[model samples]
Target chain A: MIEFTMPSLGADMESGTFVEWLVKPGDAVRRGQVVCVIETQKGAVEVEIWDEGVVERLVARPGDELPVGAVMAVLRGAAEPAGRADKPSPPAAERTPRASRPAKPQGGPPTTPAMPAAGRPRISPAARRRAVELGIDPATLVPSQPGAPLQLADVERAAAHPVAASTTRVAPSTSAEARKQAMREAIAAAMSRSNRDIPHYYLGTTLRLDAALDWLEAHNATRPLAERALLAALQLRAVALALRDVPALNGWYSEGAFLQAPDVRIAVATSLRGGGLVTPALRDVDQLSLPDLSGRLRDLLTRARGGQLRSSELSDATITVTNLGELGMESVFGVIYPPQVALVGFGRVVERPWVADGALVVARTVHASLAADHRATDGAVGARFLTRLAEYLEQPETLWKPES
Target chain B: METGKLNPGALRKILFDCIASVAPEADFEALRTDRPWREELEIDSFDFQNILIAVSKRLGIEVPESDYRKLATLDTFVRYLAERMGAAG
Candidate 1:
């Protein structure tokens, strides 16, 4: 039997809520078909199953949060025996409680609308949690079903309208505000852990960018709007290429040791339109052409803002790159997202005075900085990585046909 | 030929539409025209480039990278496009 499990997104993500399943039992599934949608800190991600089989059993409901590596479904091999397909699901260890729900009273999954058996209003655990986050008292909400247990939807519907009938001062924050608060708390927790655990070393450099700008101008002059690669994409490509020269800076440092990752995935720090930020990594940056990379970046941004990023894109970055340059910052010494050892930052390109071949001339340049964990790599390795990065930028034509 | 009849009113409508297309989540009714609309609306430079590209296509104008700074705000963009469009006529 093939077991479909909940895939972990980022280092911080512990579990994901199963929104819905695309395929049902007895359906023959092919490789790479999106089987389910999982809600994580990254937003609603369509999770794809890579194995091909006939689905036998679905283990979780819509509201259940499947923990990392938790078996979400069981699929039978096409050639296997038909009689064994009736076998029950695996033991209780795989069917863990949803992280949002409080600890269940009588162990095992809540097969029923089980509430605190002793309470008067017998509120469902999820409803009580939702009410707390929405700043509404669970007791204040009226259940839609008279005798049935109060569900999460009832609390949400009640929170939609102001609690004017009640006397408690409810926080004047909406669902969006609550979500924003949650995202901020998540970021704070990650960054705080990074500061407390990792010994960070910072390095800064100024690179003249006339050649890169000129190459970009020439490349984009005749191209259509969709094919144009922004400077952000170009910078990412350069970073991906530069990582080859210094592999130590391209992987995660965990458990007092640096673990090198094979593929060079660069996480981009993209800002959401509504609020908050998500660093979704582009897979295999070194393999993409400038135009292709830019197109992917464009698509990534649209999906990120639309809250439709896939589960595969949210996890497993070797490094993080931020372009505050686009935001018009002179330079930024950013915090490194944990597990990943380093963060590469680029500031806005501005025209500055420079001496070119013993003659003073005005040239456009940008400041790039690297914040790396000291345990992973020393300053010299980072300096070399920066030097290679600068070389790639200064001679921009090479980026189009970068050496493998 | 479609851009020959371009007026400030039409230009504003097109600008709003382009911005909307790039960032559909932006609250256009409360958006301020005089301020730097890109930052105000949280349209990053990449997405902002998308807006400019769409605008340039609709208006039949070629905006060089150098003049991107000159069109940061709605008033500045309308003024910049109007002058060039008049010169073309």
Candidate 2:
């Protein structure tokens, strides 16, 4: 049986409230299918299952709070025999309820309870807390079987049909506040951790935007509005193509080493309408054409603002690009998001006097800044990446050409 | 000069439709032709470019980057397109 657990969407996420289940018991689930929605600090994210199987049972119910790594459901593998359902597994020792778990000795920090014995139904700590909060006695709830222990789902079921009239429903507004607070805390923790751990190196370059803008204008002139590519899309394409020449800057810094990502997933930093930011990945950006990228970017931005971003988009980004241009900033020196080794920043494009080919000229220019993890890559590599990025932007027409 | 005469009302409708296509959520009825497109419609440079592209495609005229200044408002864009189409004919 494959146990589908609550995934840690980010480093700072500790626990999430089980908002709703999109799948049911005995439902056939394919890999990468969204089986549930969990309300996190960021928002409600549709969680996708990575394993293909027949769902044996859902261990958590709607409104049940669950911690990271807590098992949400169990799925019977496609190869598993259906006859196993009638056959009982070997008996094991009963699990000690959370309230009865032995306390640590004096002067010692309290320790977590020992892992439940094999064959026992696994219950999450958050679930136990939730049961207490709801005034539901876990002991009164029946387990799935004689050998199995009572789980959160059983407690939830009992709470729903309360024998006592004292049970209070958690107010939706209070939960929403809790979610926002959790998101703020998560962002704070992640940013703090990044500052504390990662050794960062910064680089900045001012590139003339005449070539890119000219190409975009010429390209758009020939096409309809729906088919025309945006400047952001073109900039993203340039960055993605530049990563091909300098692959060292396109990956994560993990385990004290730089692990290059297999594909380029450029995470575009999009500001949320609710006063926060999210950098969701545009997968395999190097392979997508300008028009395709433009469409995807528009869709991604719309969904992000509506709080409908998928779980994978949040976690799968290898590098992040923050454009403060729209906000009218001339330049930005950004803090590198941890795990990801590099971040690229773009300031507003403005007209300025330029000295090109020994002649004074007026040209549109944008400041491109890079913040890279020093532990993963040095100044030379970062410089090379920026240089390649500039080259790609200068020769913007080449970006739309078919990849050789 | 045998292509066709530029119709202001027809050109205006086409421009409005193009802008609507780029920004589906925008309230076209409330949009002010005298005000700046960005201020009135909350559109970015890319969106503005798309609007220009739409006008170009429908009229079969090339609106170069240098002519972008003339696309600031509905009046300016309509006049620009009409003059360009007339010149082309």
Candidate 3:
């Protein structure tokens, strides 16, 4: 039996409310299938199971609040025998509410057969108890809607002799305030942890954007508005390519060691519409073309705002990139999101006087800064990474033809 | 309504409307026509490209990439659009 636990979605996330379970007991689940949805302060994320198995039991029920690393479910691998499955798994105590024990059965081995051979209606523990209180068997209650699970209301309605008024909806304003508080706490914890643990070194450099801007303008002139690439995408590609040459700056520092990530996943810091920020990953960013990168960036921004991000996108970032240019800031030095060792920041592109080939000239420039974990790398390594990043930006044509 | 012969005020309104859509917080009336959009309005390249799209869509004229330099300022954009409309007509 494999234990499927609630994953730590990010450094800040400590606990989440179990919103819904997409699968029930006895269902054969494949690897990478979304098994449940958990609501966090950041948003609702569809959590996936990493192993193929038949769900033996759901340790935690919907609406239960669970801390990070709490076991959410138990699954029996396909190769496991069904005979020993009768042995009950331990109840998830952490998910239980403080005021009262849930109506669901807890402790000892499960009484009913876990994987019923016949089709059975899935009902919540509250619904089952309500059915019992009304002297009705829950199994006999047909779901109000086809394929819909029997909820507490269905059981209540069955007992109320068809005259049951719907329960008043809970006020969402309270939960909204609570969510905001939770988010503020989470950010505080994560940032505090980052500051306390990571010995950070800061480095900043200015890059002339003349070549990049020229190439972008020329490239965009030929394409439609939808296909035109954004300078943000170009900057991201340059950073990704630069990471290939300076691998030390492209991974996580954990357990007193630096582990380099296999792929370059750039975590983009996007501000949420509801007054917070989230950094979602753009997976395998080094391989994407400019247009593809732009499209992905757009999609990432949209999804981040809509609160539809996946668990992996939140957790799998190797390094982060934050661009304050849109806000017109000339420079930013960011705090490293722990586990991840480095953060790259971009500032506003502004016209400034420059000397080129012994002649004074006006040039557009952007300030780029790197904040890295000094424990994993020094100023020299970080400087090289920035230098390579500038080189890549200087030759924007190579970004289009990455292979060459 | 000859091709490219749009009224200057109407063209200015169209440009301001386009800018407003891209950067809603921008102060259109206070904008300096001689300054770069980035300097005057803090519009990034993406917003600039979107402005080009809006102009192309409203004016029904293609703003080629080579002519992006001509659309740098409000005055240059207005002149460029007027000239393009006249030439196309």
Best DockQ goes to which candidate? Answer: 1
For model 3, residues A306-396, the per-residue Cα lDDT tens digits are: 5557666777777889997776789999998888889999998889999899999999999999999999999999999999999989888
Q: Which regions of candidate 3 deviate over 4 angstroms? A: A24-28, A79-175, A402-404, B1-89
lDDT of each: 0.72, 0.69, 0.73
Which of 2 and 3 is ahead in TM-score?
Answer: 3
Once model 2 is optimally superposed onto the true structure by TM-score, how far is the C-alpha of residue A221 displaced, in angstroms?
Answer: 2.4
Docking class of 1: acceptable
lDDT of 3: 0.73
Q: Per-residue lDDT of A6-45 in model 1, one digit per residue for the tens?
A: 8766556688777556566777987657777666655566
Give the runs in model 2 whose Cα sits over 4 Å from its true position. A81-180, B1-89
Residue A203 error for model 3, in Å? 1.2
By DockQ, the better pick of 1 and 3 is: 1
* Full candidate order by DockQ, most accurate first: 1, 3, 2
Candidate 2 C-alpha lDDT tens digits along A243-352: 88899988777767787877788888775433467777787678887777878987877566555566666676778898877666799877776678888999888899
- Binned by DockQ into CAPRI classes (incorrect, acceptable, medium, high), candidate 3 is acceptable
Give a tens-digit lDDT track for model 1, residues B12-32: 888788888877767767877
Candidate 3 lDDT tens digits, B1-89: 22445787778888888887666667877878888776567565556766777777887777776777788789888888888877777
The per-model DockQ list reads 0.31, 0.17, 0.28
lDDT order of candidates, top first: 3, 1, 2
Model 3 Cα displacement at A147 (Å)?
6.3
